[model samples]
Target: METTTATGGVDEPGWDVDPDDEIASVVEALGHQQKRWREAAGLGVAEFATAMGYGEDQVRKVERGARIPRPEYLDRADEVLGANGFISAMKEQMAKARYPKKVRELAKLEERAVELSLYSNHNIHGLLQTEEFAWALLSTWRPALSKSELERAVAARVARQSVFERSPAPELSFVQEEVTLRRPIGDTMVLRRQLERLLEVGQLSNVELQVMPTLRGNHPGTAGLIEVLKFGDGTAIGRSEGAFASRPVSSPRQLRVLELRYGIIRAQALPPGESLAFIEQVLGET
Candidate 1:
């Protein structure tokens, strides 16, 4: 059989599966199933690697559940082992396993939200961030991340932007501090693109983007960021850096407090129209 070129070239790095992750068991089961299929087909690791155009080490890692297989890896394996579509069908689960656990949890909440109230005091909110800006901001994490970890983080953050494309789009309200816009997270070009992105998303009918000037001192948001997400079923979840130890709270009373703070923050900021104009001015100055 001719080797398929679907594995992104030979021996491409695979995603390390975190053993402590909730999805770890699922990945391990999939890997075990793949191994069983390979054995049933009378293929050794080396033979399977050659058939799939992957390195022997990569094949071993995938079969051992030490790595998260890419979609193409599963596809190539299915084709090689003649499992019909059985092996390939696990791609969907593997896709979710590829992201960090925290990101996955937050994404699930965002997916359920019908309305999101967000205030960012230091940096642009993740949903409204450009890929470049996200990368630059994440790169500054104090402990630093490995290359693979950083790439996964950036992808996860960008994936959250899909909320904007949902049918019957969610209502998204964002309040960004003035310094967030003026601060160059990456380079001038990166910040410029990020500002331009804000303008684009701000114009969406379901989105309200406002900027809180730095001059507004001692405001409710001065303590920190606040986020409240309301779902269609009347249930809500919220968190504030300055409240309840910054833990996510689902109780009505706690949510009300967060909502109140967010409301005031939005009211204290420039109106949406003026915010867009301010962003444009910043873009021009950039």
Candidate 2:
């Protein structure tokens, strides 16, 4: 196997996967190791299944990387194969792989951003969402997530907030529709906590938060969400949910149009100070 490349880069299976690529290599490694260890123990698939008290098909599927084994499964395999904690420790690495691929890509982009602007119509922006708020929103979405999936998503969303703590803090701005504040996603307490979080984040010198009143009739942002991220290297990416699926665009012409639309939306929305007051009033009513 190719272990290392000429560029001093790792050539291993797990070292070179793109963010959008399938992350099966690590699981595959675990499976291959399990099979070798089982053979060393002189146990056939059927004998291992009997010892582990699981079906032979289940054991075979796990060994072939066709299924993600549960923690208990790994624990039992470790004990039966006499591999100490090696097999069980793979569980921790697998947890990092549980997050959806798209989310992982988005998180990486957000991490490197020096400036970010967001406009949300249907819900609060993800960066500002509290843990409970994110849990309620994601857990209740259509085609509900499995328990592990929901946990992974909530953790990933909350982890994005680490951007706020970056050295030489990034410039961040958010424009949320007034209706989003009115609709309670996770009951009144959750709504209140979310509003409080907005207040806290809005107080940061590098952050700005505004609200577009519902009574404004219609506007450029009415169609959907918009996001723009700028990097220190003089490159930027913009995406819009209204016109198309959220795909990054770097063309200057396209970016100019998006910037113009976003600027107008910000102008029409309530000023940052007034937006905070409005949020406070809504919180009081709740």
Candidate 3:
């Protein structure tokens, strides 16, 4: 609910799409329609904002399409501007734009995955992150987030765990760096809770959790985080992201290479039973 503006005049916690993109165009069109309706109702930004119970700056930003308006914002704008259902009807489109584009794309990929292999060299995988742990991890992100943005991301990341509860759940495997488990990103309590969550998840029939010991010298996963998602139709795609940007690897040759490296990393990691024991030991020390 809290918001801030930077010196450049953009909302600190808002989303942005390329100006010429289709989504941007739709948002702009909606904004223009709202402005026209407000003008027809003989209301300035201040009056419209006061009627809508939002800040005047927010009113201006929404009308300029510089901010992605939530459903409630659109509904209030509709009532205050006398646009009836017209303004609020854009809710569906805005909803699709709610999450960052990259997140949406990744989420769609996850939806079709029948099995997933994940190797984390740093933080816990998003699908396995506890709410408090995710909040702690995201809060320290370099660019920083507005309170609202942070909450949105944390919710999205945690929601991904629903995959674990799916009927005929997808097979899932995770190999996390030992250091990631040891680092108390949040205080001791948060880290302990997260480790406990991992222990619970590791017990699932379709899930396997492994840990790569810090004592182990250089390994295949030292390159960064690697993820390969396998679909029911025998197709698989992968990517490794760390110092370099991520790109999908669907070509059979590339997938084979990634699979080979991932196989080696898995071999190097502690087995699931040993990994659970290690986690329990860490939890006790905590």
lDDT of each: 0.88, 0.80, 0.82
Which residues of candidate 3, in runs, are more than 4 Å off?
1-96, 242-246
Model 3 C-alpha lDDT per residue in residues 1-286, reported as the tens digit of each score: 4454442222322344456555677777777998999999999887776677677787777778877787777887788777879988988677656556568677767878999999998898898889999999999998999777786677567656768877778999999999989888899999999999999999999999999999887788888899999998999989987422678878888888788888999999999999999999989988
Q: Could you give candidate 2's per-residue lDDT for residues 1-286 as a string of tens digits?
A: 1234443332222221233347666666777889999999999998887787776766676677655565667788899999999998987555545446778678778878999999999989999999999999997887998665676678668867889999989999999999989887998899999999999998999999999999986689876789999989999889997654666788888788778879999999999999999999988988
Q: How many pairs of residues collide in model 1?
A: 0
Better of 2 and 3 by TM-score: 3
Ordered from best to worst TM-score, the candidate numbers read 1, 3, 2
Candidate 1 residue lDDT tens string, 1-286: 1133454436643578888888888888988999999999999987888888887877888877888887888898899999999999998677777779988988999989999999999989999999989999999997999877887888778878889999889999999999999997899999999999999999999999999989988689998999999999999999999999999999988888898888888888999999999999989999
**Candidate 1 overall Cα lDDT vs. reference?**
0.88
Q: Tell me the number of clashing residue pairs for each predicted model.
A: 0, 0, 0
For residue 264, give model 3's deviation from the true position in Å: 1.7
Error of 1 at 2 (Å): 23
